[model samples]
Target: MSWGVATLGAPTFLTIGLLLARDARSDHPFFWPSLLGIVALSNAVAILRVNQSHRRAAFARRSVLALCYLRAGMAAGCAMFVVLGWSTGALQEMVATLAEMLDASAPAIAIVMGTWSLALALALAFGLASFAHAGALHAWIAFRRGAPGPRPGA
Candidate 1:
């Protein structure tokens, strides 16, 4: 789920940030290539992890299915945003802005640092979102398992 969330989020922030950095009236773009890459990577990792833990995953089919559904929804949402940005020309503006940044007079180190900083920020945000989503899922799972949750009395 962590990988899944990050996969869904990084491209999203990248496109949205690109649009904003463009100083254009519109602020949206789709990163379709990113969606393909993320979906593949996240699902592969999930399957691999489960297989590696086969002893514990003997009956984990439902959980994995739920994860797949979540990922598909994430991918669809990403596609929608990308299409929206494409229609509005926000994606093109973002490309232009990125090209200009690369062509700026700044030193190579400075540019690398700036780009790295942006990546880190996106990663941090994605990680937080992943954790939050996982927490919610965990709660739901526990509830389904009949684990006693906090209530009015001990």
Candidate 2:
């Protein structure tokens, strides 16, 4: 795999690993791990398929494909999170608490903070997904393309 990919994926992988570790210590450990595994494996397979098919494709084409993958992953992740959170009642609880806190503040301030929180969450999700997709693309490309030649005079 490409070093670039490894570097870019480090944080995401680390975060996943930490979450997996934490889940392992919990009473219901298998659930989150299974879900995380499915998401990670599916994304990897999709990236590999795309990379294999577009090995010799133009940069612009590959980039567009990557963007598609990123958006798809983000949407899937968000949907899964929402569904799980809702089913567990965690989402409702969190929303109720947030509303309570917001209600105690000034109307304009609460509105601005709520909007800002949403924007920040969305931005963070997008950034993480972008990094993961880029890393996957670079990794698959490096794997399929084989080793590169040594630099001149090295």
Candidate 3:
């Protein structure tokens, strides 16, 4: 996959999420959540692309697998928050209306902090993914160029 989509997309989505959630205000409520879903899907696709390739260096394969798992976890976490925010909008709105009678504001945890947390988590996941992919690419190049790689059992 392209670095822009795989590497740069992560930080872009994370930044969007952070900005949307920063002041607990959003110009469009679903904007950040939709982007989060896209980020999750994009990461997942990148991992799958790596997995489906047969050209990976033997030594690099193991490390890349670990990175895949890390990305999966982060993707799942981000998707969860997005799903929750989307599914619970009406419920939260109702609660907010009800809360108006009892309190002046809605709950503090209404997707704002969750989005920020998702963004941070995605940042780590994406960083690891980039590192893993670059490592694999470099190793592949080295192998193609006949550079010496580690010997078995050595």
Give me the candidate number with maximum lDDT: 2
Q: Which residue pairs clash within candidate 1? A: 30-82
lDDT per residue for candidate 2 within 1-154, as digits (tens), equals: 4433433354555566687777667434544454454355545554555555555553354456656555555555555555655566554555555556565557877766785565446434634643455545653464333335599999
lDDT of all predictions, in order shown?
0.45, 0.52, 0.48
TM-score of predicted model 3?
A: 0.32
Selected candidate, larger TM-score, 1 vs 2: 2
Model 1 steric clash total: 1
lDDT of 3 by residue, 31-142 (tens): 4556556555555554555444424533345455445544554555445544554564633553344444443364677445544544455445544533344334323332
> Each model's TM-score?
0.32, 0.49, 0.32
Please give, for residues 50-105, the per-residue lDDT of candidate 1 as tens digits: 33444343434546544543454344443443454456665455544554656488
Off by over 4 Å in 1: 1-66, 103-154
Model 3 is weakest, by summed lDDT over 10 consecutive residues, at: 138-147
